[model samples]
Target: MHAFKRAVAPVLTFALALAIEPALAGSSETGSGGADRLVGGNGPDQIEALGGNDVVRSLAGEDRVNAGTGNDTVDGGADADSIDGGDGDDRLQGGPGNDRIVEERFGDDRIWGGEGDDLIKANRGNDQIWGGPGNDTIYGGPGKNVVDCGDGDDVLYYQRAGTARRSTGCERKVREDSTIQGRVCGQGGTDDADALRGTSSGDVCRAGGGNDDIEGAGGSDRMFGEDGNDRVFGRFGNDVMYGGTGDDELQGGRGADRIFGGEGADHLVGGYGRDRLVGGPGDDRLEPGWGEHGEIVDCGPGKDLAVIGPGDRTRGCEGVRRGG
Candidate 1:
């Protein structure tokens, strides 16, 4: 009876192992320290390819993929995923669903936040990021990088004093430099109408084409409304406003401000400080005495009008319609 029981136990153990083999086999994989390729099956997978140029494809389901220390390519396919490219020039594609992608320092990377609202944090390198068709948030690390927030209202946090060439469908924050200067849209074009707001430090904000609304929140600010009918608001501190082209509106909110309405019919309002309003080309309207101190209005060319509030001063502005 003891011999029969031992033989039966061995047979049962073999059968049990065969039964569980299909469920445990080939669902997940990992790579070694050499260049390798790891692919995940259609389940919540965890894949790690350590220390080599690797390719990791998370084919479906919620996946967490880590490509460790190599020039790797990681694609997070569908569903929510988290991918990290550790210490190499990597290309990360967050395909289809909302994903979190992290890039390690010391290599130029290309990241695509594809579909859904994704968060992409690029490490210290000259990176190129595309926030494709979703309200994504991107952090451009301490390198000269290019980010295209494709469609949707995306937010980009960029380096201080770093130059940004262009932005479409995005609200960008230009981190304050050592000089406490924040510059945005200063040397580029915009595809859509942008609403630009500045920080407490001195800022230079530029609006390129498209009907834009720009506000200088605090500190001494400089605003340029280049092309398109725009509204420039200087909220605080001594400010300078330039309405480059198209019918535009300029408001000097506080502090001593200088306002320029360049080309096209414009409306200039000096809000609450000693201000200078200049109307350059085309029919324009300049308002004064909307501030604590008296304002000076210069009607540069074309049929321009000066609207005077109480206690306002004007020069070269006459025979034009006047109002409060």
Candidate 2:
């Protein structure tokens, strides 16, 4: 642990160069309070750069390096090393070794684990990470992130809040639930299931081809369940929902919503307001919200069941179940 004082990065760069030059390789070194440039040797060494925007590099061997504070750049040059970027916006590199890199700061950082299996934990801020080769594990903190695990099996753990995470080349991705804002889209063209949600403002969601789940939270939203068995919820405001080409369940929660159960045996619930429920080409079950009136239920094709109320227009439904 080290006490850190914030210094201007531009001033520290000039002061560090005049104060200390590059040390001999393979030797243990410690930096001054100002921003310092510390270079490690071919053999194992310990480098601790306390305070300021320092640049530390472990050229070879198993090394331990810690950049205490300020915007720092640290590189684990070769072999296995443990590197920690203590605070501020940092760029960390684990170059060609099984390394453990930790960014415990609140800044937008960039990390690259270049070759060999590595473990990286990016704490707070919108981070960009690349796990280059070998099996890797990456943990992203709060903020929008772009993670590319290039070549090899990798696992990424992220959050599903308002932060947008774009991940590629990782074999497995696990998301922790948080409140969402705006639009959320599913992975199209793959049979991978996605959980999508919307915010208070009008949002759009397209669940493509997988067994998906969606929740439209508040506002007038447009939701599409493109394929597979899907469940869609329009929680508030006037919403438009489509269960496209699958056995789906749609709940229209409040407002004058339009819901369509397209091409499967589906269940539709019109939960209040003057709603329009269309069951297209399936043995569907349609039910209106409690104490609803002036609704339209059109069950097109197949033996469909509809629970209608007063002033509710119903056509193309084979069976009718009276509401209480």
Candidate 3:
């Protein structure tokens, strides 16, 4: 009976030690060569799970995690964190801070930047990124990626080779000569001359610096030429074109349209349908031709003149000149 009691006592003590082991090791850790699980306590910690299918939870405070060489899962729980999902198909969540996540090659990844202005880069494999809030910047590389910038003014950069299926919420910068087949309604470009063309659906396209040529091809679209000397074409549907600054040219094609020349000497041409042209604040020229119907011209707060076409109608326009 005494020998039986001695064996039972040792078993009970071992179970107790195993229960307390996680609490003791919760502060910081480096994983072994096998699959491991590491959890951070309620303080700032640095964890490196090196070579296994590891699970890391950085509970609170600013933490840095490197999920090194296997299929892993990491949660950056509050405060600003930097997470690197190094070699396998991984899942990463930036709970509520401005986090930076980098996904390396091989295996598909799923990443979420919960709140704050986050930066996420998906280097390879088919990946998915969700920028929950704030103005985030996301880059999709190589594989087919789906990115949803949930709210705020965000920016997305995608490669030309792969398919980047993007939802409506962010400004997109497509590499030169690449086409976005889906419906896009955001600002385009940085300083490069971007040839932004829209899909058949109605789109709102905005251009940045550098001379840009934007075409609103099929649907009823709105084009805003923000800066530089821009040429905007509203190809098929009823469109609204705004030439913000610089010597700009606005073309309203097909259906009933409205064109505004914000600043600088702009040339506005209303093509087809009943159109309205407003020359805001510059020495501007307006051409409203009565093809099947008439057009309205409002030369607003500027030394503006209307080059009237045959059978064109002009109202509140100061200077009028006949166009041959």
Best by TM-score: 2
Off by over 4 Å in 1: 1-27, 174-324
lDDT of 2 at 175: 67
What's the TM for model 1?
0.47
lDDT (0-100) at residue 45 of candidate 2? 78
How many times do residue backbones clash in model 3? 0
Clashing residue pairs, backbone N/CA/C < 3 A, model 3? none
TM-score list, all predictions: 0.47, 0.48, 0.47
Ordered from best to worst TM-score, the candidate numbers read: 2, 3, 1
Q: Considering summed lDDT, which 10 consecutive residues are worst modelled in model 1?
A: 17-26
lDDT of 1 by residue, 128-172 (tens): 777787767676777777677777767676763442553345665
Question: 215-238 in candidate 3: lDDT tens per residue?
Answer: 786799989888888777775688
